[model samples]
Target chain A: MNTLKDKATFKQAFIDTLPVMSGYLIMGAGFGMVMNSYGYPPYLSTLMAVCIYAGAMQYVGANLLFTGVSLFSVALTTFIVNARHIFYGLTMLEQYKKAGKEKPYLYFGLTDETYTLLSRPLSVKNKRAYRFYVTILNHSYWIAGCTLGALLGSAFPQVRGADFALTALFVVALVQSLEFHKRNDLPALIGAGATLLSLLIFGKDNFLLPAMGVIVALLLLLPEKEAKA
Target chain B: MTTHTYLAIAMIALVTALLRFLPALLFSRMERTPRFVIRLGQDLPKAALGMLVVYCLKDLDFTSLQGYLPATVACVLAVFSYATKKSSLFSVLLSTIAYMLIMNLFF
Candidate 1:
């Protein structure tokens, strides 16, 4: 009975993460379609979805790989692009510490969606289990979607205009994030401004890194008075 | 594409996994993290989000920021909708529709 109860809990946790899971599925499929169109085999794209698990970066990397960019440049770019994740893990320290043997996989599964879901408030009994489930479920959805797209690509002569789905997903994420943290529009405004400024200064090809750099620096330096709970 | 490319990808994956997993493992052993570290962690998401927002607008032609006037209007609508505590999905849908209409009609 105890084991059965645990199983039910895990199942529920997985179900709870379905919203984010579906989002990943759609985005991953978009990526897979793009990769297929790029002349890479479907299986390789599926493998990448499972292994690298960085959605947007993978899309960018695919273009770079196709262009035969240097491995060193790719590595450097990825490092800079994902540098913010280092700080994400810092916030999750306490929650992850309690994951015990499953800790490794928990860390491995920390994508943007997983991180967002895990950071939400939940009951004590469900917290750790939910985090684990969200991590696994998000990954599973992405991998499954990539595989499905690969298999379907052969049948569809051309899978065009799929990349726009990423833009839609980002819009959804931005709206959700804004909704979650009410009464504070500073971050959003700052991000929009910094991004526009950076784009103007650095140009399209080079804007992301500088925009992110400025945002991170400002966030680190900004002083905030503690909110009264 | 080549054997070397596969090897390089595998190496990147290995290093990424290590960087991602190591922090969770090491920090989980500690009973408490420093306050500054905790604060930093809390702020990271906001910073990351800022970066993503910038990424979304990176390709816009500011010289014709006028061309994207509808998107700008939609952004303002989204802000007001959010401030009023309206549903996020509704705000996104409405704004998107508005932007599309403006683009189709004007540009």
Candidate 2:
């Protein structure tokens, strides 16, 4: 009955999940409150959290929910927004395969936060169990937070500057990456330049696709030149 | 739920999962799946992080001080905070809090 029986493994995983758990709960609740504003009930928000499992996308989804957009747009937007996960999956192939039976769910649940944590690859005795527990724990926190947000949204409908946290998040990750691995500076500069150019050309609503396209193109086209030089 | 609701959920879920899995599935069997693709994966994070930060400020109005000052200040705060702690968590937390307070109080 208890496949997650190892007390030590569970404890370690829980400890690892603690910081993100609190963050997710708060963020999830913020999302839930937004959904509540959109006239969705708590159960539906919970369902979205459980099924969709992408925090930023769900926030965008809530915005799109009431806009009466076509289903095709929803799907397209979903892909564009979460396309970053594809890079995460590719980068994680070496480590994810090690998760064994947990690979499927690990693949399915690799949200931005989970991918960030796992990208560094924690040094744990039970890597498989740790990955699984971390994924599931993150999911649970999200679900719980969304549900709470929904329930409380009616009372607190406003969350100002909350979305800024996402940008701040990227900053934090970029800083950490730069600190630990200095080699990323070139790509970071390229990415920043391409994104700024694309944003100027594409506009906010349409910039992501072009930015990603530019990143891949630059990475593909520029590296050989540098290597030879 | 209506047909569209069900369809939306199924489509979004299916597309997202497939995307996340596509890379692994492509590379799982072959030891080498083009050096460029591997390098792209290696370098993508840094670029992606940069893009994401710009993406956040997409809505800010650079023409006006009120529109841009808070984020600018907070980013500086985050940079200084990261310089000291060298921890992403603290930098984000402090910068985000700084942004939130500034937004709530002034903007």
Candidate 3:
């Protein structure tokens, strides 16, 4: 038994995830409160938290739900919002290949936080249990927060401007990505410019797909060295 | 939940799960994928984050300082706070609380 791996138990997983516990609970509660303020039920909140476990999309979803947007819009926008998970899955393909019975749920729950936690290099005896428990615990924390927030929201509705947290969260993500890739802001710049251009042409409600299309076309056009770099 | 609502939730879940599932299924099964596709995946995330940041701010009245006051201030605060404090929780909490106060007091 390697001492380094630490036998990744539920206790270890729980301890490892303590930081995420605070983060998830607060964010989840915020999402729940927003949904509740939109007059969504508690069950709906938990159900979304369980199924559509992507935090950013779920946060954006409250707006979608409130507006009662078209199903096509919901499907298309969500694909773009959570599209980064494709990269995550690319890296995780080998590791998750070992997920076996837990594979489907593993893929379903591979939210950003879970991807970060699971992708850490951990030498373990049973990698499956380690990954599985962490995934389950994280999902449960989110569900708990969402459910509580929905209940509170159902009790007292009118909490406007709380959705600003969504913008804040997006900024944090953008900054984090920017800081990580200091020299290569070209792609990022292209994305922003392309999106704004598309939005101007297509209008906000119909701009997402076109914006993503432009981003993809431009990204693919980058030289191999520049793109990979 | 209404039947319509349930359908929306289910559709999102199914679509999102499929997004995560496709690469795992495709790359593992196929012997060759285009170099450009892999490169795009490598580079897309940072760019996508940038796109999303713009998308979030797109609705704001960015043409003037006053029309976009609270949101602009909060976004700048969030970015700067994150730079110094290096804590997402603090940045998010501070900017959000600051935005709420500014909106109520001034806006």
Specify the highest-DockQ model's number: 2
Candidates' TM-scores?
A: 0.74, 0.83, 0.68
TM-score of predicted chain B versus true chain B for each candidate: 0.68, 0.85, 0.70
Give the range of the ten consecutive residues with the poorest summed lDDT in model 1 chain A.
A157-166
Worst 10 contiguous positions by lDDT, candidate 2 chain B: B1-10
Where model 2 places Cα greater than 4 Å from the true spot, the runs are: A1-23, A63-70, A121-130, A156-159, A162-164, A179-183, A224-229, B31-33
| Clash-forming residue pairs, model 3 | none
- The sequence of per-residue lDDT tens digits that candidate 2 reaches over residues A101-166 is 678889899887777666663667766777788789888988998998898775744557755665
Q: List, residue by residue over A104-153, the lDDT tens digit for candidate 3.
A: 78877777667656654555566677788788888998898788878886
TM-score of candidate 1 to 2 decimals: 0.74
| CAPRI tier for the interface of model 3 | acceptable
lDDT of 1 by residue, A190-223 (tens): 6667777887898777776677667667766667
Compared with the true structure, all predictions reach lDDT values of: 0.64, 0.76, 0.74
Model 2 DockQ, alpha carbons vs. true complex:
0.59
Q: DockQ for each candidate?
A: 0.35, 0.59, 0.47
For candidate 1, the docking band is acceptable
